[model samples]
Target: MTNALVFLDTETTGLHHDRRPWEIALIRREPNGYTTELRVFVADVDLSSAELMGLNVGHFYDTHPSFRTDSPMRLPAGDEEFQTGPGVWLAVEAKAAVLVERMTRGATIVGNNPTFDVEVLAAMLRRHKLCPAWHYHPIDVVSQALGFLSVLNLRMLGDLLAPELAEDLTPPVKSDKLSKLCGITPPEGDDRHTAIGDARWVQRWYDRLSNPLDGDDETTSVQAQ
Candidate 1:
């Protein structure tokens, strides 16, 4: 398998079925420590709905004011100033092409709970008349952690391997929270909602799982493998 992993995350307008992505962040990391990160602000959606989803104008203007003017339609200017009728459709198409090209190179997509990201990306690609080119099976860190803990005796595993994750591993344990699984605090600050920040956290959690600190037993050691 390729040692390249693509950590992806998206910030959407809403969680509704018809919602669309406004920002996307993809980080490609290699075993040699070479990393390439891409963050694109897609301008093909209803900004009004994005406002309702907590992505207000102030948020964009403060962080990326360029998105307002450089997007499909130039904001602060009227709809008459729109450069394209479809609103940045070409930009969306270009970004989608980049994503497809990178994924097709054999890099596996990884995310905290990647299903939503994959779904949103797929939807965006279809909307732009682009094909979803990545592998059907993406690596979901949350799901992997949950499945690994489901069959094991948490109490025993905790005592035998990761005592830090013990208390949080109570019976009927139900959560994919990285903080709970890794015994680390949830990421804060700019990392809270941004795609790149969240992707970094996902990568951290995955790294911990790949090289566990303490796991001598069969079950726990298998997790490291």
Candidate 2:
């Protein structure tokens, strides 16, 4: 088990391999219970695909700080000194630099669809000649919840299975639903598709699974401090 975990989430333009992340969130948790957070809105986003996909991730059209010229946010080249904070506006280059500085390279990642988050972040990092060296293993919240459900003999991942068989099928349980089935209360409304909201959901879900009460010994702690 990884003693350090970085719960990550990204709100992107679309669902395909060509998707671009416009918002990113990270919550780094250390064994001694120390926590740090960063949330930023990446500027220079090409929302063409987002328009095609009808994507308004995190209510981006209305909430992004960059959309308004007078908004106070940390900018890499401005007089504000570029401090990290939630809901700030940042250019991709600046965002990549800050992410490289802030990301824990050794922390195992935890997220729902963690690979998607990793790949998206990796693309942005590599664009600036930076590489992600986080711990090789990642915990997928959906998979973890599904594992718990599998032990009860549930069979509802037909969406994945049907893909192998080349059939069009929708699973009864999506990732969020699976998280909820395992006792995670996801955020509501505007926060639904936001990066920080989802990252917090990952953290809450993992803590719930790892620290069950009533003498439940089926789960173990993810930290070692």
**Best prediction by lDDT:** 2
lDDT of model 1 at position 34: 60
The lDDT values for all models are: 0.59, 0.67
Candidate 1, residues 1-225, lDDT tens digits: the string is 555777788777777676677666676666565666665555444555454535652245434423644542333433211123211221343454455455434577888778888887887777757777776778987766665656554556666655545665443444434346555445576566776577767766676666567442122101000
TM agreement with the true structure for every prediction: 0.66, 0.74
Q: How close is candidate 1 to the true structure, as a TM-score?
A: 0.66
Off by over 4 Å in 2: 46-51, 68-91, 152-172, 214-225
Q: How many residue pairs clash in each candidate?
A: 1, 0
- Residues 1-225 of candidate 2: C-alpha lDDT, one tens digit per residue: 536788899888888777778777787777666677767667666666674443554566665656544564545564322434443335554454456335657788999889998887777777767768888788887777767766644445444332333222245457666665556678788678888788888888887777644332232323211
Location of the lowest summed lDDT over 10 successive residues in candidate 1? 216-225
